[model samples]
Target chain A: MSAQSEFDREIALDAADGEPGTYRGQLGEGWRIGGGINGGLLLALAGHALRRELGETSADGIPGHSDPMAISAYYLTPGVPGAVTVRTDTVRRGRAVSTGQASLVQEDETGREVERVRVLATYGDLAAVDGDATTTATPPQLPDPEACVSAAQAPPQFLKHATLLERLDLRLDPATTGWAVGKPSGNGVIRGWFRMADGREPDPLLLLLAVDALPPVAFELGLPGWTPTLELTAHVRCRPAPGWLRVNLTSRTLSGGYLEEDAEVWDSEGRLVALSRQLARATSPRR
Target chain B: MSAQSEFDREIALDAADGEPGTYRGQLGEGWRIGGGINGGLLLALAGHALRRELGETSADGIPGHSDPMAISAYYLTPGVPGAVTVRTDTVRRGRAVSTGQASLVQEDETGREVERVRVLATYGDLAAVDGDATTTATPPQLPDPEACVSAAQAPPQFLKHATLLERLDLRLDPATTGWAVGKPSGNGVIRGWFRMADGREPDPLLLLLAVDALPPVAFELGLPGWTPTLELTAHVRCRPAPGWLRVNLTSRTLSGGYLEEDAEVWDSEGRLVALSRQLARATSPRR
Candidate 1:
């Protein structure tokens, strides 16, 4: 089998029980980021768990919805590779919108279960709603995807250990990737085309990971380092078409060691799929 | 007492319990918008409750933080005037940051409890951490406060019943308030100076409401009406100095009857007090 299938199989979860709403999954070695798993992957895992729980028969007399309209996740502890469990609670099941909360936990060395992530999501049927206005906002103008430099072509020696990079194909816009050449733009913006490494179709859950998968926008502001998210909230406006996603991220200010990152994702068909905002630590890079 | 003083008294919450973390408050007559209490005031009420809970001695061994780092609120239902209770749960108490969740619930007609609002907040000491960088973002440029038209001098007939307006004083930037005169610039931006109507000092809690106090940005797009928030997330960066706050709100896309509003609040000293983004319904106004 190919590496893409292997990565997908490792991330796929299995339902353990339907009554109390539980799922069992594991973070394979491919999802590792440094000593722990990626935060966006964990969020997607919880979102997938919630999707399964809500996909069931009507809970609280409200039918299950398919698209996630809003999702907020809080990271309490770094996730480890091992047996993991996800428990979901259906907060309210309304006709137009439904809300749910999920907790991702794993066993510690003492055999005690510890919570690693907590997320709340709201899902609704986007097609059912009538359109009030058409979008005048166009996708970010960029060079042809085929003409751009793919992150998969030549892995930098510094990022050799970043196994997560192997799961996604990122075509960085040559104009915005100046940081790769050590010439920071100082214009807090990053734009690029992104898609699954395995040529898999993009979905709402995949969009979640794609939003944060890019290098921190702070890198362009002369700050080179990992900026961990304190909290991230995303709003899904429409379902994505089957193709590459155009993403643009920017920050207006970086003050007091904290900065807010705003991101927008547009599908290949020129449709806005999701918008997200995250408050993260802007740690000074140690060179 | 002036109407401003009366409005403040109505929204002020009282600590109902010294332990277990509970607050009792009421939404009075002046706080109404249409038929329900204003959502911004509700957020402020919850923020106040969280501030009070965190201000007490360390709970669960976590040190008491001084300012709100991030807050997210989901409006489950329209709030009604009566006795409302806010119960807080300390999720985790760390040395630098603490996490907590609060549920704003009220008793229904049958005496059964119903949750009207849910919020999660993170609190930390802004002064404890050393500054790594400075912001290049300047506060929204507007005319002096004394030269602008105050929302208090005259109440428009459409907003005559909106008593919540009496509690907060708004000096509209002449360039952005053209919607009041049946003309719009179609720029999708609003800038103004805001403070409590009763001359009350703007605290972290007040900053929460101030972020959403202005008219929805959708009005500029020729869609005039009530645009309610589905979800709003805010990050408080610094302890706001006592003075007027300069605010600017903008929207990038309005599609499929939904739009996201982004706002920034800067204190008179040019310090960014808060940054917020909200997903709200873009409903058309009835002609």
Candidate 2:
């Protein structure tokens, strides 16, 4: 078995100091839209950095509470492609859960340190928890990967330059991919399959990307252009098993040119891995 | 008009210094579950403090971004009843949006400072925005407040001591409030009407409480007991009009003893005023 894959290499960050929570890394080229890197990718990087810092060092003699229960990030500024620093502070540590904050920073054009993203997350050891377990929510019925349309094919002109989209094997359920061709379903729902292009084992961090991988569901409402996310919060219920993650994204309200997206990520095991909601602005397609 | 109503008196916090961002206050008696105070009320306090700090004073020549766009809080510790300090720090100041962090702190039994809650929020100026305005989501149908059952009456024994519940007049939609009588609707949806008991105007802060005011929808799914939330994030779409806020709360999944709740608050004007999603654990009732 290979020790490391390109997917891991692209997302990995090295600790800047002997200190455990301070790390520095740069996003790969072409892994961006306009001047900013993908929000999901940035979230994943921050989640990974946080997991490395808090989870691995739990004093309970247990390996880690690598299970990400909840995480939210605010896109404070545009994260340009360059060396970025991630600093995490473990805020509180308890028996069953831990809380921390991670900030993603980088220097801007004038060489001033610009904070790009601020993320707060919580981790929990499910084994330590006691409660009733049940799920009434079912995964959306979707076409098998082999039968779906790959987002990589027939890309919209605006997204043609987003090579990062190619790294994730994203296939849209044919019925929901109509917006790509200018014909929207108008139902404001999108279903698809998301898996790492390199086929790495699925983990909590990967689930973060899967939830945000899809374009805003509002695009189907005939609203054009890039929808920039203002804030995103994701909840991870449990560790996911390996296999393609099924994504169901829905927009409940599109008001004042602002929309809120709700998403669910279900693993092949039929287990709900993560739930996410984001607030974003629907900027019309450039005239 | 009275300078302070009982509802406002309970939720209000005094600024600690001439400094606009710092505050000192205490959660009112009977406003807790177990030893911790209510998360919704904590969020409301932070939002009020933030709005007071950012909105009341804007050098932009325009008013402050009193319109809260998004806010997320991580419960780090059980916020016990005590004199607590809330410190706010402005993270970023922009023309249209401002981001900040608020920390709710208290001294523990050992006299050590414990950070009970950490919140990050973003504010916007709706007046500064332009574009298509519309709301595709509609409020759920419900009986008039007079026809509905007040959550105030027939209180669940577990919440009998909660005085906070009395401050907020929450009436349930008859169709979904069956859980109170031990009937599981098995639908996992709860509809209700929420307004300040003292008849205060329905503002963004009060909407925060309204979103979380309902008992966990899972309770109606045969999942018994307190469902303690681990993290909650709310998006205030626009300033709400004066009147009772209509609330719709739904849970898409309850898996691995965890659940995610999505809530929408519509003002009497039928406009979407706030959107929220929460991640929580479903701890069953004691045997």
Candidate 3:
């Protein structure tokens, strides 16, 4: 596939480090491999690995894909100074889906094992994963992200910090009153429109990433800006290669400390492209 | 606090990526931009992010201290080619614990906007998440991983595939086969003892990653290898820092094309370190 070259050009270039390579990238700056590279950077690197594997590569002449819904990692050995190596392989592949695994390591200067990792990835047909495809109806009618007000729009004075809600383009279903994270998105939601500007206007990809970002609930209770989605699995039909994909996401908080959220991403005209579901450990500060 | 310097010295001054002045770490030769990195690496990165924000450095922090019970990720735009950036911050760092958030992205040629990612993370007095952290009382007696029939001994047909289980050093409590995966675990062990290698060898971090490696079973069909995880979550507690970790996983195959598994992890000494729960969309070609 044409994408293979793109994948190789992007990830392979930096594909060295265990002890030698330095953690690269901006988000990686926040991480302090010893002092700064953070967890978010590690995840981005992992995602980079995935894209490289799938970008131009396909299994059995078919592109192997996985809409990751959840992920868990253990920072075993910190990325040490020196040569680093990423070891990857297809754990298992199937007719509809495939799983790939990778490990990031900082070479051991003294011949000792440094860090290790194991991944469980799954790929499949879109129908089973996308609620939008299964939704026998249309998405709920709602205001545009531009016309909506921030639900958590109280003063920072009343709280302690700023949240993504403050940085997001939000719209709520009038029917939600605010409990709208997981209510039925009405009829066919042909599009999901989410835009997060990281300086200049956000691009379509950024918008999609933000739209497909962790559920709003994930950021609800923690400090100012904290929403970490360990893994993501999105299911789509005739997956869109849209110029601008708009996603309408909603979530439901369960009684136990669990929360379930689903999002329907669409093209501008109201054509549902995919469905995404996520589970998060919901926490609220004890008053 | 001293750990910070330890962490800093570990990854600082590494080689500048070919991009010049940037650090590079290999994930795999084939993975990169727009291609998603491996899930395990992403999680590790996220863990590193959380630790950085929590002011915990070194493996001693974040992934170093977690007993992961659950995790979820949302894949945004495919990772971009070349250096991705990641940003992480603490969500709620409370007395016994707190939560953190991480964001991963790839820079554009302009290095302006981030390409993708936002993660939600939680950290607490691990016990808090598992409300059931009381000690389990019994005459300590578990089926030695060595004594158990190796998945290798199963059959030639099942040989190649069980590579994962073969390396597992599963320790099942004799009174209840709680920590086993795939099969043979008996008793009302809502959970059981599981590990990749069966012995005194210690590899806690790798085991933490292993916890997420299990297939998300849709139904309790005793098929060969076809469990698709829809979602998974883990609540952590306390346990061995740099040693073997035990997984006590058990699942109930729901009739409606779904299955739910509950798992708990422990240290070699039997201290409860984490609790896990998961749901899966089970399907297969055989049964």
Candidate 4:
């Protein structure tokens, strides 16, 4: 099987085909070196496809936005080589919390199963922050999008050793903010306007994964050999009518080869949508 | 209104005492000032106290030993000084996870409540590790007890701080070896051997709070100035037999004025019995 482009290939939701308690996924061989399909990516894709049956628009339809996700993914297996298929099923859904199981599968020319995973999720209404019934958008003010080149404008770095995030394409409204660097294939803590990079009107879930691609704004403070995220727990703040979203990202605390990053994502209305904290393991690129 | 040395104070275990439906704590003022607590203390207080309730013996039950527990304490509140009373309630007791809620409270002279802390804990089964079921007592192969001066031997930075710890009379076995630094009353991460500075053994419950006296190993790698913690979730691998347990500790990561330190506590038999992880706001002594 070959996957040359997103439009050129087609697959249905794995839940329709597989039963509960079972999973399948591809362990991409060339997916990682510096960049590849890591935990965040897999989680996004699986969560996205699983939404239709849940009576909610994909995490994208939740309104306002940049990655205002209150979810996290735990990496149990590395992305290996090959085309991957993700299967998901509802594990439990309550008024405030719900869980889903996802499995990644890979097959050789003969269609053999490779790697798989099952995830449990818990989500809540972000509308209750600081006693506010609906999430309020009073975030610290940031410069306009046209005034700077956001990390969104940078070409995403897709590592050959791992799964590359080829699905994202970003743009900076200002296209030339001074402090922003690496407009092309931006690397080492992205600074920019962000989006699906595919020109799709912003979706919260898509934004969630996109933000994960960039380093936290705090990282721009200049910490080196940065590696972050063994786990991530995000708090969703506000939701607004969607439009261009801009954010500044930086990295810090490059010590012990392990680090954590915090992000503040806002909406077009300047409302705070979500905040994420990620921890990652530092790995030197194999020369 | 004044708190004298009311050491013999005891409070009945009222199962239904405390405000329900409220989820938060008043972190002690001192633990937030960069350095506070060690894992060995946490283990003794937590593990020993729990064991004692389950019909275990005192510190005198163990003979030759050296178990240094370098652990993590994610600070939720500053300390609650004065005739402190703690209440520990078991939440869940599964084979894989044993959960408990411990609250330390202090009442003002007028009997007004001043501080309260709730710690949710997980004590993993020792069988989870590749070790024997019953704890062994093989002393660590190190110098004789006459060779090294225990951390308790070091001059107390605050002569007054020593008074509180000195009353406990915690003596250490020589085989315990590790590196640690001291923390001022209001600055920096501290580490080193930790036991009751007083030669007398203490009730295991009171002993756990002493770990808050050492510097969190995480602050070593935090940002210049900041300490933030909304919650603390800790896991202890096994239970150390009560006695003078020694722990080798180090400050691990400090970034964004926030730090995280993961520690391990091992007994004289080279068996790992406890571990902890703490998240702190990364802050400099003075900006």
Best by lDDT: 2
Task: Give the CAPRI class of candidate 1.
Answer: medium
lDDT of 1 by residue, B22-88 (tens): 8898877777664467887888788777877775558355568657788888877878888899988
Highest DockQ: which candidate?
A: 2
Residues B157-269, model 2: lDDT tens digits: 75664566767788888888777787878888888898878888877677777777776787777776777788999988777878888899898677667787888888887
Query: Predictions ranked by DockQ, top down?
Result: 2, 1, 3, 4
Candidate 3 per-residue lDDT over residues B132-197, each given as its tens digit? 322322223446655543333434543333333444444434334222244533232322345434
Candidate 2: CAPRI quality band: medium
Model 1 reproduces a share of the real contacts of 0.57
Question: DockQ of every model listed?
Answer: 0.52, 0.54, 0.04, 0.03
Best by TM-score: 2
Give the per-residue lDDT digits (tens) of candidate 1, residues A148-224. 76766533642664577788888878777777778878888888899878887777877778777777788777777
Clashing pairs in 1: none
Q: In order, how many clashes per candidate?
A: 0, 0, 126, 92
True contacts kept of 2: 0.59
Q: How far is candidate 1 from the true structure (C-alpha RMSD, Å)?
A: 3.2
Chain B, candidate 3: TM-score: 0.56
